[model samples]
Target: MAGITRRKRRSTTRPAAAPVTPVADLIRRDFTAPAPGLRMVGDITCLPTFEGWLYLATVIDLHTREIVGHAMAEHMRTDLVCDAIDLAAARGFINDDAVFHSDRGVQYTSGQFRAALAEQKIRASVGRVGSCYDNAVAEAFFATLKTEIGATIWRTRSQARQDVFTYLHYYNHTRLHSTIGHNTPAETRTNHYHQASAA
Candidate 1:
C-alpha cells in the first residue's frame, strides 16, 4: 500500500426505490421478438451537466433495438417513465400482446406507471435487482449512446438534451447495429412492415 493509488469508492446500490409488490423477472434475458413492437425494454440513464443531472428515460423496441420513446427530465420520477411509456403507446409501439420490460426502479414500480400500462393494455415485465442481463438490450443501448455521443460534460441540461435528441435521430435512422444484422433500427422496422404489407 506504500505507493499504490486506490480507486475512488462508489456505491454499488442502484439509485432507485424498491418494488411495491415484488414483480417477477419476466424477460429473463430473452431480449428478442419475432416482430416489431411485440417486446419492449425500458431503462433510465443519467446525463451530467454543469446545471445538474438530466435523467433520460427510454423505451426501446426489443425487436429492432429502436428507441420507441424517450423523455428527458431533471428528476427520475414516476411521471418521467410514464411519459416515455405513454409516448410509445400513442405511437402504436405497444401491440396487443406486447410486454414492456424494465428493472424494478422506483419509477417503474410506482402506481402511476402501473396505471399507465393498464391504460395501454401493455403487460409490465420486471427483472430482478442487480441483473443487467434481464434488461440487457436497454443497458446496451445506453452504453452505445454514451459512447457515440462522446460522453462530454455539458454546460446545461438543454444542451445535453439537444445532443441526445440529434444522436437518437441518427441512431434510429442511420447508425447500424451488429445485433440487428448491421442494419439501422428504422430500416429493420421498415423492412418488416413493408414485407408484411407486400405479403
Candidate 2:
C-alpha cells in the first residue's frame, strides 16, 4: 500500500527514573462519559519538522470527543502536559472530579504533572505500560490527526504549528463525528448543555 509515511521517532521511551506518585487507573478503559467535563484523556505525539520535532499535547473530552485543551512545543517535558491541562482549566472544561486519563508516559508520571493535577483538583488516572486500550480514545484522535495531516515532513516548526492550528479548528468546528450522533464536537457539547438546561 502506498500509504502516507510519517517520520518515526525513536521507539523506546524511558520510564520516570525518579520516584513518582502512582495514580490508580480509575477509568478502567471506559471512555464513555455521562457529561462533557467529567472525563478527559490526554496524550502527546511528535510531528517531524525540518528544523526539529514539534511535540503536541492534547486534552480531549470523552463525551463530545472535543479537544478542550492543547499545547505545542519542541520538547516533551512534563511542562508540556501541564500546559495542556492548564489550558483545559482556563477554558473551564475541567471539573474538580474529572478523571484525567493518560498512559504511563514519563510526562504523565512526573512529580510536576501530578502536582499540577492536584492543584487543579483533577483526578489522575494512568494506564499500565504497553496498554493502548487504556488510552484508546486519545490514541484514536492522534491517528485521525496524523491521517488528515498526512505524512510529509513539515518545512518548519512554525509551519507545522500553523497547520495544526488550522486542522484543529476544522476538526472541532466542521468535522461531524458518528459518536455524538454525527454532530461536530462543538455542536455535541453545545447541544448537551442546552439539553441539560432544559431538563
Candidate 3:
C-alpha cells in the first residue's frame, strides 16, 4: 500500500457514426417521358444459383410501368438484351420512335446491341456512367425481384429458371406498384387504353 498507484482506464465505448447519405449532386435524376411509347427503360440483373448465375434482361414501358418483354439466359451478352427487345417488338410494345434508355453497361453499348436497336429504328439513350438513379425504376424492380421471390442460391439452374419464370409472371400480372396507383402493370395498361379510347 505504500507505493501503489492506480490509473483509471478510459471507456472503450464510442458513439455510433451517422448513417451515410448519398450527396444530392451524386444522385442521378430520373428521366422524364417526352410522350407515351416514346420512352422506355431497360436493364439486366443477375440471379444466383448453386450451379451458376442466371441473367435477366427486361424492357419496361415507362408510361404503363409494364414489362413489355424480358429474357433470361445463362450468360449476359448482347443477345440477352436484343432478345428482350425482339420480344417486346413482337408484342407490339415497341415502335420506330421509341427511346430506349439504359445504364452505360458494356452489354448495352456494344456494337451488336446498338445494331439491334438501330435495325428497329429505336433511339438509344445512355445514362451517366456509374449512376444508379438514372435507371432507378429498373433497379427498383430488380431489388424487388431479389427480395420477394429470388433465392440466394438454387440447387440447380433448372430450379432457378423455373423460379424466374414464375416471378416474372407474378411481376407482370399481380405486383401492385405505388407509382401506378397501386395497380398491376397489366391493369394499368388496360385502364390507360380504355381511357384513351374514351377520349
Candidate that would win on lDDT: 2
TM-score ranking of the models: 2, 1, 3
Candidate 3 lDDT over residue span 1-199, tens digit each: 0112222322211222221321122213444453345678889877666576678899988877778889988888779999999899888878787888877676777777878888888887766756677878788788787678736667677887788788878887998988878988788778877888999
TM-score of candidate 1 on Cα atoms, chains taken together:
0.89
* Alpha-carbon local distance difference test for all models: 0.82, 0.87, 0.72
Error of 2 at 128 (Å): 1.0
Query: TM-score of predicted model 2?
Result: 0.93
lDDT of 1: 0.82
Residues 1-199 of candidate 2 have per-residue lDDT tens digits of: 1123556654323456545555789999888999899999999988887787889999999999999999999999999999999999999998897889998888898889989999999998988888889899999998898788665588788888988898898899999999889999999999999999999
- Model 1 C-alpha lDDT per residue in residues 20-139, reported as the tens digit of each score: 666666677888899998899999888777786788889999889899999999987788889998898888877986799998777787778888988898888988877778788888
Give me the runs in candidate 2 sitting further than 4 Å from their true place.
Answer: 1-5, 9-13
Candidate 2 achieves a global lDDT of 0.87
Which residue pairs collide in model 1, if any? Answer: none
